[model samples]
Target: MLRQSFTEQGKRVLKIEQQALIELEQFIDQHFDHACQLMFNCVGRIIVIGMGKSGHIGNKIAATLASTGSPAFFVHPGEASHGDLGMITRDDVVMCISNSGETNEVLSIIPVLKRIGAKMISLTGNPDSTMAKLADVHVCIKVSKEACPLGLAPTASTTATLVMGDAMAVALLEARGFTADDFALSHPGGSLGKRLLLCLRDVMHSDDATPIIDQTQSIKDALIEMSAKGLGMTAVVNQQRQLVGLFTDGDLRRILEQRVDIHSTPISQVMTRSCTTADADMLAAEALNIMEVKRINGLIIVDKHNTPIGALNMQDLLKAGVL
Candidate 1:
């Protein structure tokens, strides 16, 4: 019975929060556009300030803005009062977040921020609150009711504020033409960064490490080259070093079944002539896609002139963190 009651209460909370978000959709009006424009046109960083629970949400909002192409950082309102206020500059914009817009710690620094000549934006539940009145632009994050049964906790309000922050970040992101490449630059240690930034040239084995063999070479010689390089495959090239075919472990199995003599049979007779290939400049993620769709484990990197320059396999991608 207790578990059932707890589950019902949790469901009630989620339902209330969901309705709050649905109502928030109506609030994305001219004011929201004005806030986005303010952030998009700013020449300097955005300084986000808040207190207590609002401070935690503000921190996340600042991080989202910074990672999405907008220069931003969070500043505790209490810390700002005690000398950290120097971080604010005339060219910067200040975003103040307070549920009631009457947080003493935040209101106390308003004068100093004004003196610094920073533009102010406010996110509050009350549109007529003091912070809203003082700000250059105001965004309302009001919720119809608190998700907490007691009606005191900040559950719904905090969720609304977070959604509003995301709305603003994405708006500015699109306005600035922020591409995946640009986002990857800011997140070099993340998976998306590796997918977008790493190319075949960055992970492929080139030069002597590339298993290249003359197309006229016997299957025995091709196997020797493949074993020496350990790429499970060898690129069959012409006398002029032009890629003609590929011989892999799978090819070896088929030839063995056909009873071909490895010492006398030329590799070109058994190698795959229409092997999948990638350019050196192609993204590693794109190469992975090709390998997956073609159901092949190995891929050869070719130059513009169709010369075999490098080679990589699924194992190579795993080592490079592209998998």
Candidate 2:
């Protein structure tokens, strides 16, 4: 059946890659440590180079290293032969990737790169190959078999190479003490950036924008403030400027059905006595969680005395990239 054939192929790929990973573990030696040390000690950026499929993997490794505080970038080996070799300097480190360890385009530029006095680290399947043998440090990435049944396509070999690249990037990441804040700085346009960079005070409404009422105020006054602010809610405070209760549109609708006189009824009798509030210094992402669990659309920002300092609704969170 077609399903059986597809399943068998999937299993074969996993098996081949799993074995490749096991083989890669044995390939890690003193040279791997030296490569890490060379990269760590370098004052300048790391320039990664490769050809064909190796180039794609090299590009990803360079991006990972750069984002994790390693200061790296990728360059095509073919382009290096054309004059891009000027990008490398004596203070820099070059990481080269090649399956055969004898890529013509890469090997052709080695002499010029070396003459520039740049340190070299080579990743290859053949430790005896010229590229690996000539480099200052060599990392072996040999695989026993290709995931392709034809044994011609670059399957398990490429996966092994990418995994080894990830291992090197992650090891350096831990050694450098890279934190989430560091990652956020590198990805300022991402969700993690918004969560880290945005604060409660940044998205909250201040001054007259917040709906507030005195504890002795009638329910009608509270409802008028809530409607004018359009936050669907208002905070009730005492004479000491401390929060007392909250009044929402939901409470108004329920009380309306009872035919209660809003003008005569005190807000304290109908308002939610125990209300949730957030601090101005908290992250906006944390505010979103409180809104989700409390199933409310608005929150009042309060000080230590529980006095309403600011306010925000779900729309505020949306505008601030918290949602």
Candidate 3:
């Protein structure tokens, strides 16, 4: 019975918040468009300010904007009253968030911000409140009710505020034509960045580490090279060091099934002639796509002249965090 009650309470809270988001959809009108245009045209960074819970949400919104090509940062309203207000400039745009549109700490900085000649955009539940009425633009984030059963804690209102903030950031992102490569620059340490920026040359085994064998070598010799390089495959090259074929673990299995003599059979007779390959300059993500489509476990990197220069397996990409 206790478990059932807890589950019911959770569902009720989600239902209320979901409805609040639906209502927020109606507020994305001309005013939202104007706010995005103001942010897009700002010469300096977008300075976001709020108090308490709104401050926490503002911080995330600022981070989102900064990562998506709009330069932005968050400022505590209380700090602005002391001396941080100097951070504002005539070229900057200030965005203030307050649930009631009357947070004392946030409201107190309005006159000083205006004095600095910064354009203001207010996000609040009440458009009639002092902060909303004074700002150059107001975005209404009004929710019909709190998800809190007692109607005291800010559950539904905060959810609505966060959704509205995401809408604003994404709108600005599309307006600026932000691309994945641009986003990768801001998140260089993450997996997405590695996938977008790392090329085969950055992770492939080159020089002596590449498993290269003469096409005339016996299958036993190819196995030795594969084992020494630990790549589960060996590139078969001609007398001039030009890649002619590839011998992999899959090929070894098929040859063994046919009872071929490993010690006497030349690799040229058993190696795959039309193996999939990638250039050293190709992106690791692109190589991964080729590997997936061709259903192969290893890939060889070749020079412009079709000479085998490097090699890599799925494990290499996994170790480099590009997989």
Candidate 4:
């Protein structure tokens, strides 16, 4: 029996896979560039097909491509031979993944794909194998060795394939100038999407919910308004209802320490005249950045006319999942 500890064996596997990735770098030649350009120029979606373990990696690659603006989907090669090939179109690009470059299930459908007139890019460990020779562009993902001690499992080769897929997806994303907002649109349910798409207008406490008080109002009146709205602050506006200042719980503490009379003192006299404010149309993420930089817990959203339209604090952002 092997005497190596579990930790030692784990480290051995990692080292083997690491070396495989290092060797995989040399295979990113002109063939890889041609494959990317083919996918980039395709008028329709990029279709990725592989069998077994390769198919799993292909699915992830297709998803990465789709979210990064390349628009791709995966079709199992076995399924492809079973009427799923109808999904492929002449205007699309088909990517085939086969470690040996000789997957029987994968090879069985190449002739049909060729007949469909779709461009093909082959990702395989063997550059001279049948699938590579049949492909329009062949990308070699040859690895030095398998991470499995017996050299039977698909660890290193699969890792190399997945990393190569990531490289291609990112390269294509850069070529397309895919922005974070574009990526967010494709992932609207994810945290990144919420952070990118959520605007102040979408999360701010607006209308009657906005805490506002006249500049001439007493500090006690501002406190009442803040307590009513529960935003920890109140916007101080002039007779025109245009924002002039802000008063918050911090100001109340400062007043308390000074022993000032809230009922007699006007809010404008104690309010923060030069305060951090955000535009109503600004993204909530941007607002969060501003609040963080200013070390404040609340924000006031104003329009082009400098009129206070909305207000929010950290709690509002947390509730909206912008935190």
- Candidate number achieving the greatest TM-score relative to the actual structure: 3
State residue 32's C-alpha deviation in candidate 2, in Å. Answer: 2.8
Which residue pairs in candidate 4 have backbone atoms (N, alpha carbon, C) closer than 3 angstroms, thus clashing?
A: none
RMSD of 2: 2.7
Can you give the lDDT of residue 299 in candidate 4? 92
Compared with the true structure, what per-residue lDDT tens digits does model 4 show for residues 11-102?
99899989998998898889989999999899999999999999999999999999999999999887788789999999999999999999
lDDT of 3: 0.94
For 1-323, candidate 2 gives per-residue lDDT tens digits of: 99999999899899989989998998777888899999989899899999999999999999989999899999998788878888889999999999999999899888988899999999998999999998999999999988989988888888988988888888899999999778889988977789876888998987899899998999989989988888889999999989999999888999999999999999999999998999999888888998999899889999988899999999999987778
- lDDT tens digits, residue span 93-131, model 1: 999999999999999999998999999999999999999
At residue 240, give the lDDT of candidate 3.
90
Question: For each candidate, what TM-score against the reference?
Answer: 0.95, 0.87, 0.97, 0.96
Candidate 1: residue 36 lDDT (0-100): 87
How far out, in Å, is residue 234 in model 4? 0.5
TM-score of 2: 0.87
When summed lDDT is taken over every stretch of 10 residues in candidate 1, the lowest stretch is 33-42
Whole-model lDDT per candidate: 0.95, 0.90, 0.94, 0.93
- In order of TM-score, best first, we have 3, 4, 1, 2
